[model samples]
Target: MSVVSPRQIAANLAELWSPRVIADVDDSYVKVARVEGTFGWHSHEHEDEMFLVLQGRLRIDMDSGAVELGEGELYVVPKGVRHNPSAAGECLVMLIERKSTLHTGDQVTDKTRSIADQLRPL
Candidate 1:
């Protein structure tokens, strides 16, 4: 396999809240996406989701609390925990999630991207 840059992939993305798969690790997929504004409230009932900030800042809000992450930082949203991700400005993020994980979990909104859409080549 050839080495690839997830940051470059994220930088090239023209759409917001759309994630592109960069690689696969065992049962998980490595994804890159751009974020701005709100991504709605959603949860993966059977899997946890990890988010790493590649650029700018990100805020993850849950019923229990909220956390802000800057570049080079990461956070994991536990399974079944409803959370909403948002950013006041543009942010680049990498996500590691189960292969069966849905983009917006059980909540399907206009921003919800299908696995097929994420699997497309960058």
Candidate 2:
């Protein structure tokens, strides 16, 4: 068991998009990621995906258009909704997804999804 600081974790991982699992309880995993570029278009069949921008800009592309998220902004993709996420520049973000949810719902392309694999020490 351990206690960690987000700021310290952020400073330690200042140059990568790798996510560190900060906590896990019940059916939820809390993680932090550094992001840039565009993520693949995908959807969760049974879970909602939450993205919280800790810094920089992030956007979610919907069929209708795009929703831009700034620092402190958050966006949640509803179940079974198709969308693509992008960031013009490097951004810090926190994600909350179901413990059993796949990073990509139905999309199976190589770049279709990202799972939080590395849990950095915080």
Candidate 3:
């Protein structure tokens, strides 16, 4: 085992909305991503997605309401609940989800990323 730095990893990301798998635990994958603007509305049919803010701010919008997260904060989007994520500026986030989880859940959009793409080494 080795130490991993989320901050350093996030700083090296060259693209937005692209997630890189950093590690795997049990049946889950640990990921880091850089994001800006807004992501398409979507939901995981069989998985709960955990989003932890490493930097900047994140706004998760659901039909019922919205939740804002800042650095060091986290929120878990329950399975089957439609949600959209947005950021006023650049944001770095860490994600934890099942290994089979899809980036865009049941909704496929221009920003959709396959597990193969997300598996790229950091």
Query: Residue-wise lDDT of candidate 3 within 95-117, one digit each (tens)?
Result: 99999999998888888889999
Give me the candidate number with maximum lDDT.
1
TM-score of each: 0.98, 0.80, 0.97
lDDT of 1 by residue, 13-117 (tens): 999999999999999999999899999999999999999999999999999999999999999999999999999999999999999999999999999899999
Q: Put down candidate 2 lDDT per residue, 1-122, tens digits, no spaces.
A: 67866434544665454566787868888877777888778788899989888888999997777789998899898888888988888888888888877755777765433553544354
Cα lDDT of all candidates, in order? 0.96, 0.75, 0.93
Question: Candidate 3: worst 10 consecutive residues by lDDT?
Answer: 6-15
Residue 75 in candidate 1 has what lDDT?
100
Cα-lDDT of candidate 3: 0.93
Clash pairs, candidate 3, are none
**What is the full ranking by TM-score, best candidate first?**
1, 3, 2
| Candidate 3 structure, TM-score to reference | 0.97
The reply for model 3, stretches above 4 Å from the true place, is none
